[model samples]
Target: MTAIKPGLKLKSAVCSAEVMVIKAPAGASLTCGGAPMIGAKDDAPAGAALDPQAAGGCQVGKRYVNAEQSLEVLCTKAGEGSLAADGTALELKEAKKLPSSD
Candidate 1:
């Protein structure tokens, strides 16, 4: 688990996915490709591969949020891995509906 904060950049250990933290709760564990994400400046371990079960693929420019919506991250780069928090897969945050000007 990492102490995440807004503006912190992270990269996947097993894929090319990268993200910036927008909002994160304390003690949240961010994962990509079923492996814990590492700091953007850190080097990934040797022989790391994408997890077949978590290969949902990440989309660039998308916002992913946890079930409680407390943890959110913006995808800075796309890759063949999905985002997850605390073992639960994060979902794409839907755009807010605007009121009609009738």
Candidate 2:
């Protein structure tokens, strides 16, 4: 079953992420910090599930969406929580800028 999902991109320069497919219960949702996501369906895209607190806390879910396994998440940048080609996060204060050759 496929559905149109509207969500934010996850990535930055200093921090990075991986997409994976997890084995979780039917209706579980994966959360990083507090944001929720599903398995990235598009080729260049990006989900979630699994109880990190449980004893067998290996990172997997119905569609974990991480670098360890999934491919859709490749669309987002590594950090700063924005799309790879987006301008808002690319202009971060700590981000380095190349000097103009002129």
Candidate 3:
């Protein structure tokens, strides 16, 4: 068995305001938002609006669209993991032994 190490780390990287979300499954009849974007998933049927109290707020996999207005979306960290970034998995490092101080 092998233990995996951490990789590259980029702190709060400020990206410009051109934020984009690409939906999948493109077609000609639909409103084409230009190339590079595949478009919305028509295969994925229109989802049901969720109740906040029932769902305990929005989840990841469970599909739901925001139907409510003036909802205070308090963006909080659900959990945290080892902060890693793009790059090689770091060179396989060998553990070094220290000399006896005695």
- The model with the greatest TM-score is 1
* Greater-TM-score candidate between 1 and 3: 1
Question: Candidate 1: deviation at residue 54, Å?
Answer: 0.3
Number of colliding residue pairs in each model: 0, 26, 2
Looking at model 1, residue 66 earns an lDDT score of: 93
Error of 1 at 45 (Å): 1.3
Candidate 2: tens digits of C-alpha lDDT, residues 47-66: 32222332121121112232
TM-score-best of 1 and 2: 1
lDDT of each residue in 1-102, candidate 1, tens digit only: 458999999999999999999999888989999999999999998888899999999999999999899999999999898999989999999988799989
Per-residue lDDT over 1-102 for candidate 3, one digit per residue giving the tens place of the 0 to 100 score: 011112211111111001111121122111111111111221212342222222232221222111221111111111111111121111112236689889
Sorted by lDDT (best first), the order is 1, 2, 3
Provide the overall lDDT of each model, using Cα atoms, as 2-decimal numbers.
Answer: 0.94, 0.27, 0.18
- Cα error of candidate 3 at position 2, Å: 33
Candidate ordering by TM-score (highest first): 1, 2, 3
